[model samples]
Target: MGIDDITKKAQEFLGDDKVKDALKSEQAEGVSDKLLDGVADAANKVTGGKFADQIDGARDAADKSVGNE
Candidate 1:
């Protein structure tokens, strides 16, 4: 799936409020590049590295949505 699709799925799974809270908390705490790397790593592991690009794009879109970018 594409980034938008992944984002939509995540939102659906996690709920908007939870997602917003996570984003806000992360932003307030100052997310590190290493954290993003960890996210990528987790995504890669979850998908067996088959959809790495899509996961990266989704992560970027999620960050943008949360006003981090």
Candidate 2:
């Protein structure tokens, strides 16, 4: 799938509350947050914000993956 499609699917899976809760645990939440932010920042820098929407989608994917949002 394309990046946007991949991100959409990933976000759906990350919507599970149990998974979300587990991801937000004190032990892992900090790392996950930092990782997502770093990845988003890197993408934005690399594309000069041309793909800001895609980067945001990826961020949503990460957030859902870690059950953060």
Candidate 2 residue-wise lDDT at 31: 80
Question: On residues 1-69, what C-alpha lDDT tens digit does candidate 1 reach at each position?
Answer: 899999999879767776667765656335644566688899899889999989899777655655344
Each candidate structure's TM-score, on Cα atoms with residue i matched to residue i, is 0.44, 0.58
* Residues 1-69 of candidate 2: C-alpha lDDT, one tens digit per residue: 799999998898779877667777875767877888898999899999999998999897767756334
Candidate lDDT scores, in order, read 0.72, 0.80
TM-score quality measure for candidate 1: 0.44
The 10 consecutive residues of candidate 1 with the worst lDDT sum are 25-34
Q: How many backbone clashes are present in model 2? A: 1
Which candidate has the highest TM-score of all? Answer: 2
lDDT of 1 at 40: 86
Off by over 4 Å in 1: 1-29, 32-36
